[model samples]
Target: MLFTSSSSEKEILSIISKQLLLGSTDARHPFRFVNLCTLDGNQPDSRYVVLREFKEDLALFFYTDSRSEKVAQINKNPNAALLFYHPIERCQVKIGGKAQIITNTELIKEHWNNVQTEAKKGYQSVLAPKTAVSQPEEGWVQELKYQSKNFSIIKVRAKQIECLQLDDEGHLRIGFNKKQEVWQSTWLVP
Candidate 1:
């Protein structure tokens, strides 16, 4: 593929949109999982999270337990990062942004409604996440009701996006940052 400055920018955006859309349909898709990074004091914490939703040119959505340490970290410091890699395509994307927890909102409720009962059971645990347990089964109770309070969604408002595409012919890198409420993109050496 030819990589002119203009064409590369367009191709980068196209790839991002395509991969995000693919995540919604293909469970095995590379974009289905993202490495989410949060700060715990001066230390960095990272975990693999499912990519739940992608809003074009806006933000990414993921769900987590409100009692989880990541949620608490986000509440304390909203700054976060997400990294996604499509090995088959040899494309990688890194996003830096601010994260906000959504709970008790219509959006959260709607997300919960869409989840299956079996998955919803995850939020119904009586004990908080990361709690010590003598046995694995003792961690969760056979609850009669789902704990809506524990179900939380995260919205990561992207401020910058860095994408790299590696191909047999050549490699391309592009960076996009929000400036004056508009996205300004530039080509980076890969």
Candidate 2:
């Protein structure tokens, strides 16, 4: 287990922050790809999204096409959740937060500039995600585009974070809730 039963809350929080920061830049990190959950009316919608950025303030950011169904869902309801797991470490981190589509043109442009040439195709698709297509290729852009108007950033401001460490001895579960800009930690039943 990454954390033991006697591990302090600060230690766990530090580990989580470091792992998330590393995930944003390390392609091979297990946390690089996370399951993002959003609400589609009464149903839950989920998909894998790359961890684009992890801010010092504990905000998580992901890139997506502005026209995608997830974008619509987020617009209707900002509440969302993210799950990250490290199989080798037997650690799972769950985050509950509010999501907001970043609309500032300058911020979007800055992030867009950082996207690799080949990776930009995801946002440049002629057809939006989840659109019905006869062939898989029909959803892709015929010509490579330098800039994509559909590129957008989804930022999740975490309200609560929970970490679970699995071990033969005993599983350790801890939770951190943000209240008035302060994070209060508590031990939870595993």
Candidate 3:
């Protein structure tokens, strides 16, 4: 496969219309991530969080404490980069966007009430992610129809997407930009 002609960005983006998190190699198919914001300035200051849902091209879902450091960072810098990888697909997707915090009590309750016990456990981590190295601990958890008002959801509005593929075709880097309310993309050799 070889080509050297300019094409409409939409033509190339058609292959990636589906919202998915794929691997860049063969050993991490399920390892997924979402873009995060931080005030630390280091690229790694960003965390790899499980993406809970993708709501069309307008929004993406993630859960967190309204009091966490990240919440503060988003309040300051809303721009971020979300990365998702799946080893089995030899694919990697990077998203650049602005993060919007959702604070509607009704919406938060709806999402929280549906959360299973295992997932609900995350609420405790907001306090201390690695407090006990090797000892018993004390903490509070939610199991009933209750959630902290601080429980928040972050929605990412994607403005650009970079999808990379590696294989027999060597490596390809494609970028998509939102233009005039439509997506336009371009291919680059990497």
> Which candidate comes out best when scored by lDDT?
2
Q: Which residue runs of candidate 1 sit more than 4 Å off their true CA positions?
A: 1-6
TM-score of predicted model 2? Answer: 0.97
**Candidate 3 residue spans exceeding 4 A from truth:** 1-32, 35-37, 41-44, 124-145
Q: Write the per-residue lDDT of candidate 3 for residues 1-190, one digit (tens) a residue.
A: 1111243455445444343422212123353354454554544357766676665564567888776777777877788777765466566777788887887888888888866777666674434443444434443433444445556888788899887776674766788888877877777666
Model 1 CA lDDT for position 174: 87
Ranking by TM-score: 2, 1, 3
Cα lDDT, model 2, residue 112: 97
lDDT of 2: 0.92
Which candidate model has the greater TM-score, 1 or 2?
2
Q: What is the alpha-carbon lDDT for the whole of candidate 1? A: 0.84
lDDT of 1 at 150: 84
Top candidate on TM-score is 2
1-190 per-residue lDDT for model 1 (tens digits): 3233457576667668778767755779988999999999979999999988888766788989888999999999999999988887778889999999976588888999988889998888888989999999988675648757789999998899888878776788889998877888988898
User: Which lDDT tens digits does candidate 2 get at residues 66-159?
Assistant: 9998999999999999999999999999999999999999999999999998888787777778889998878875446567598999999999
Query: Model 2: runs farther than 4 Å from truth?
Result: none
State every prediction's TM-score relative to the real structure. 0.91, 0.97, 0.75
